[model samples]
Target: MRSSFKSSFGSQSTHRPHKMGYFSSRILPSEPSHFTKLYFDIAPGQLPIVYRDEYNVHFLGLEKLHPFDAAKWGHIFQYLKEAGVIDETAVVKPNEASDEDLSVVHTRQYLDSLKWSWNVAAIAEIPPLAVVPNFLVQSSYLRPMRFQTGGSVLAGKLAVEWGWAVNLGGGFHHCSAGRGQGFCPYADITLLVRCLLAHSPAVKRAMIVDLDAHQGNGHELDLGSCRNVYILDVYNSGIFPQDFKAKAGISRNVELRHYTQDDEYLNAVEENLEAALQEFHPDILVYNAGTDILEGDSLGLLSVSAEGIIRRDELVFTKARDHRVPIVMLTSGGYQKRTARIIADSILNLFNKGLISRTNRNVR
Candidate 1:
């Protein structure tokens, strides 16, 4: 006695057979067209230096210490190549920083001194082991530091254009406006940031994520008061350049206690970074991905392992991507045994994740 229309409205009658092919076509995903750019200092080995004391072992294996040593960084390229994650290329030579470019964050006096020293050293007959090498160690110092600073600036520009980019050498965070501190000859990050901000309209604001075991005291000083820049430094609390936190207002210095492990450190990063991102919705993110946090790092006081370091890179880069912020990365500070390869590998993992895609060709 049921009505004929009742059958038409039934679930069985209304349902159609699922088409496997159509379903698969709609759900399948294509490979992402993401890439990474790696900027390097090709002649880093040629930079002049005068060995003063027995501490020359610090610069041994000049090729390895070349700041942009491929042996250390080549693995990163190889990994990306093997994984088909990125199209890699080297930065061209004579990638020198102009005087105007250096002046953005450095004092004219310092720049002049650097130039005079290089000019004098080039002509001097001083011994390799001399203290000053008869070079005009003036108030203004520029030259090799410019190369690194310029390279990093270029990297930042490329990262903004692309999604990610890496500077094989940089993170000279200890350099300040008036003087160079620690091993930093120039405040590379400062100069680079200033250049990026002035040139790029897209980058209205930026955030620096410094994960070096040492505090980025100089960076805090240089960019602390700037309204557009936000800095988060995760380092050992009580070491080097004392009174850094007090001076640098924008910084969140996470002073790790000695013997801190992976979980504790990572948790701290997770907790603080969320707040920082909320507070500073930056247009660009710069990561000082230092490998000095490795378990047995000579200069690092923490006991983070190789895996821990990789996780650190993952956390920061992932957060950048999630927030849709372009990232510029630097190989900051890492002086453990076989420092180069270890640092390179850590960066490669991030490169392999399809970050840093601009090449020399794309850069203007």
Candidate 2:
């Protein structure tokens, strides 16, 4: 079944069958969307990292209601600042993605669906947005998402140039091109990979390493087993968005049982990732490094400890670097207050271990 499904996924991209019914299964348009200033080169002093103050969603007391901290990005940046890893001037500030930039992946119909606050509320998993005025919701929630989406796209380009890049916000893997769901309002993952493939002749193949607690159905459906994309998703089996159909697209899918801890988790990751490297070589690696796998994350269900999460990230980056593959990492989930601290710590570990460095082609 897996082989046959894989063949179907490859064929659909070339054939473009009508009425596939899935939300994000539609192939994108041939032309690039606007090709705006997103391609601007970073200075030699700048880090291959992207973030902005607006990336945090804090319009009112509403953020307090949700378990996920919409303000997590800012907290992570602040911690990095105090730690001397990064500062305001050193980190790249991404431009907000304009509507045309989003159109590359989203259809007009799916984009229009966001007009109703009810739809947006469901997408963001924040019920209060349903009653908020659409205009206010747009500014408060959607605008922040657009900025993160832009960061993801820019990070993709930076990864192709530098060996690694990180977007402190993004990893909307649950939102595909035509639909938004699971706390993800935009198909940022799909857009990033598509943009890289379209613009860079050197970038032929890409790998999506989704370590998020929830299934990354959006990009799975969006790429639909496309020939060049190799998806390796390791998530809790007892979680949300159990899209059996989408599972067909994962080149290497590892679903863990509930409450699974460090030993079993690390073993699975190393064996599977090693096997993936042997089977396929991707030009770029997109790491959805969601910290929700932390032991206390209720939504994640699994019991991976703080040290485990840091080890997990280091393993991925080290292996990818050894194989000479560039990487783009996105902080997809795990917005608990502690998640920020954990992410910052893991990043620090990466730097200390000499796994990640701030260098430019200028230095080269």
The local distance difference test score of each candidate is 0.58, 0.83
Q: Residue 222 deviation, candidate 2, in Å?
A: 0.0
Model 2, stretches more than 4 Å misplaced? 3-33, 361-364
Report the lDDT tens digits of candidate 1 across residue range 73-188.
Answer: 33444444465543423332325566665566678886565544333333221222123432323211234445556667777876776667677666878777766655576677
lDDT of 2 at 210: 91
Best by lDDT: 2
Give TM-scores for every candidate, taking all chains together and pairing residue i with residue i: 0.69, 0.91
Alpha carbon RMSD to native, model 2: 5.7
